[model samples]
Target: MKKIHLVWSFFCVMYVSLAIAAHAEEKIIQGKEEIEKSICELNIKGQIEKEFHLYVTDGYQEMADGEMIYFWGFTHAKDFADVEEIKTKAERNAKLLPLKVPGDEIRLTSGRNYVVVLHNAGWYETEEHSGINHVAHTIHFHGLDLIPALDGVPNLPYPSVFPGEIYRYLLTIPEDIEGTYMGHCHVDSTNHIMSGMYFPIIIEKKPNEIYGYTFDREYTLFMSELDSEYMETLREVGDIRRGLDWNSNYFMLNGRIFMDNLTHPLSTINDPKTRIVAYDGETVLVRLLALGYEHIFAWHPHGFHGLVIGTDGRKFPFAYEKDTLLIGSGERYDILYKIPDFSSKRKCLSCNYGPGISIAHDHNMKGMVSGGIYPHGPMTIFDIRPKKMTP
Candidate 1:
């Protein structure tokens, strides 16, 4: 009877040990599962939000002919400590926040939320405007698939943003969309766009995703034209509704003529924007955007052919190589330009063959001139240096 009791006790102890071991294993698995769930929640909450403040106001843009043209456009609004401090800050940073033509570049990453608050400041008479220049404006992303309410078309889904009014544009760049896009005024698009109310928006691919090809440098080339007659009408009439011929007197890249672009690679004298800087044996990605209302630009590189890799926010199935590409109004092209090694025959006049300069300009002969001035229109220089030289 004692031996039987001992065996039963031993079995009870074994059962208790096994039960405790099983419970401990279950608890460990549950803890691991909880940790994994928490990690996922953290990843979901990690999406970033980008915000910007843009003010739409009437301003003056200097033309290549040394004339200040009256125009309606956007500018970056600087942050102040309070509403009362804005005037003092503006006075302090007057040179820092001068009126910018071509607006500001809207750069956003894929898979993020962008909130741009547009404030319509009442038009102030400048030397160019004198007594004219009054118009409502709204921002319209040319190729983005956004909700109708957020679209900046006036009187279609919402009214145009008037003076002293504000509108917030909420946008979410999809993870799949990555390339160059354009934004401009949808209200009185023909006149407003011609009167300098457009900008470029670039969406970059995420880090983890492979964009197929990597580039050493990138440049944004915004090709646009100006009609002086239409601008004059806007200054005289103060009404954008006045119909005028869409004749382009000035062709520009980033608001500067060819000579000015060569001197100031990026933005015009009024604002600094984009410039092309590269070295030999290096690759560059050029974001080509044509913002003209009617003209089509045939962009040609002098020394080398560019590999057309993408268009309108999507990569091509295969790269297409061409020396000249025709880009119409509201079109974007992603061209990969590979800088060639310098040859004695192709050396530039300025660099003694050490750093070669090649001209990239519009293929259309008319586009090469601004206001009847030769070599003063839509053109820029590609400064290619030896691999050892700094760019």
Candidate 2:
């Protein structure tokens, strides 16, 4: 009788343990499913470790009137916490987002990560009849066009005061495809932008898919512009005005030129005179976001049209092949292509798009022109090679 009682107790304990384990697994699975949905949200917050400055140029200098502008352009961080690890006030910020979704009330622990959903992650909307809204609403700035457009917005009565404060949204990432994604303010402000305000965020994919290629390897590059002339115009206008829209003349990938230049000596070319990443593989996905006013991005791989796998954050069933990807303003394209099989004119694989596939650039015929004396600004390239050969 005693032995039977002990055996029964042991079985009951085992059963309870299994039930708890099963419940935990279910919660994790649910988290992953919620994450896979199209719109991803991240609860982002930060602390200004010190008196941090927002710059518009790559180089750092004070304007003649004495405003600190980063040399070349603005200086924002790739990650929020790199400046200072702080808690996230996502719910507080979410109130400002236009497209609110159905979900539980969530609070983000400052340093810890959390998940949310974006009903309209990349969509832009104007504020109400408020002064800020009227100016931001009067014009729609995309990619590099802000430098010129912001000129028309109401300016500060004093030079020492900024025209208006820029506002941004906060979100969280579900656990499925957690990694780095890029975002920027979608308004026009050339000098303000080049000063340094763009940044990147991480989405923690659900545990099961945390490491695998459940989807595909992908990245997003935001292209924008800044203008000294436009900044001065805004300073002069002192109030919002119509008919101020100008095509984006400057361009940048991430924040700098996309070419392979250590120091961006040339300012006329939008050609990002720097390189971002090394891309050599069987399948590569490049997400392109055009934030300028009215330029079509003719993104062509040097030797390939790059397969079109997705658009505006939505995946497509069939791939569209083309030499130049004509992306309109406020558009996003997900491109995929394989590494070159053979060489072109030179011994090594080149970055040109005619026959051999090696490079990527904008096909906005006019955008290829230099900004004033400088070349286009945001042009970038991904060097794709086999993983085995990567140094």
Candidate 3:
């Protein structure tokens, strides 16, 4: 009877502890709130078709290991809904965002004139950039057809924008060119880009429809890596004076990594910007952007194959199918993935497994490893569901 009582008490204690821990975890929400809209509003307070007020600065992204990695980024400063809201220069400083790594994804319509007011507010030392540096920064529109003047390269004629300086980049997107693109810091391209000063630049024929193709859903798998040791050196010295040794360890998909990335709100399971969700027979367009300094990102899906329709923002005349895709730095690939519908039983021999997940991850060992852990980096998922199962 005494032994029975002790066992009962032990079970009760275990149950109570688990309950307490559950309650504690319930209060902690993973991932940040969707600060920027999935696709930002266009024609925001400008006479042109689209105009962006961007603020440049620094911020910190807390990695899966709880390490706060410092990054340089751009954030939407002003989306002046009303003309009355447009005030002095100080007003633009109100919505400065420096905490995000990839910056805001700029979506533009084809055959529309757009302008970007690039304001260099310097490092992320403080929310308000009181102390500025001489280091210049510029936006190099990778894979986008642009003139040398707007190229964002540091040269004698068109110098990169420095601290406390603002430069306006104007471009008219041609109807012929509309697809995946990228924008990054061109000044000290090696150091600046690797340090996390980049974002996806996608020009669409419309919203979800990319000219010849239409997608039920879309996701941007922006692939990049972090070298903690190299970053640490830059963090301490304020710059990479010794040149890039090129030792990246942590690989990420849309700024999140590993098992934590799979469950975290900032992941494919949650982040609106990179969630791979599709119903039976639905098509999901995945824009693969490799922005890292080194390596070829070899990615593949577990259950199904993807149709490679475009590369580097240009649609190919013929769409080819591939189970695995290899993309290099500064490169982009647009692949269309069609979910096998459960209703179409003849087509889905694999659907016998039923509605489940298909892990889309980098096959490259470097992409899958970090700090001696297998399957620890650059992973996302494709949540496929039956017609009845989907909400």
Clashes of each: 2, 91, 0
Instruction: Please write out the lDDT profile of model 3 over residues 95-165, one tens digit for every residue.
Output: 55435778778888888877776777666443232222346788888887676666777752256777777
lDDT of 2 by residue, 168-280 (tens): 21232232333323333333444233323344332333421223323235455555444444433433442334225434444555444433342344321222323423334
TM-score of each: 0.77, 0.48, 0.78
Rank by lDDT (best first): 3, 1, 2
What does the lDDT read for residue 306 in candidate 1?
94
Which lDDT values do the candidates have, in the order given? 0.71, 0.38, 0.71
Give the lowest summed-lDDT range of ten residues in model 3: 29-38
Model 1 Cα RMSD, 1 decimal: 19.0
Clashing pairs for predicted structure model 3, backbone only? none
Residues 1-391, candidate 1: write the lDDT tens digits.
Answer: 9999999999999999999978866764565355445444544776336557776666677665676777767776454111111223243235224565676678888887766666666566434444443467789988898866567887555567776676667677888888889888888788878878888988887532225778888888888888877776666666555645678888888877755433443323223344466777778889899978677899987767899988988789999999999999999999988776662126555423233666678898788888788777777767666677763
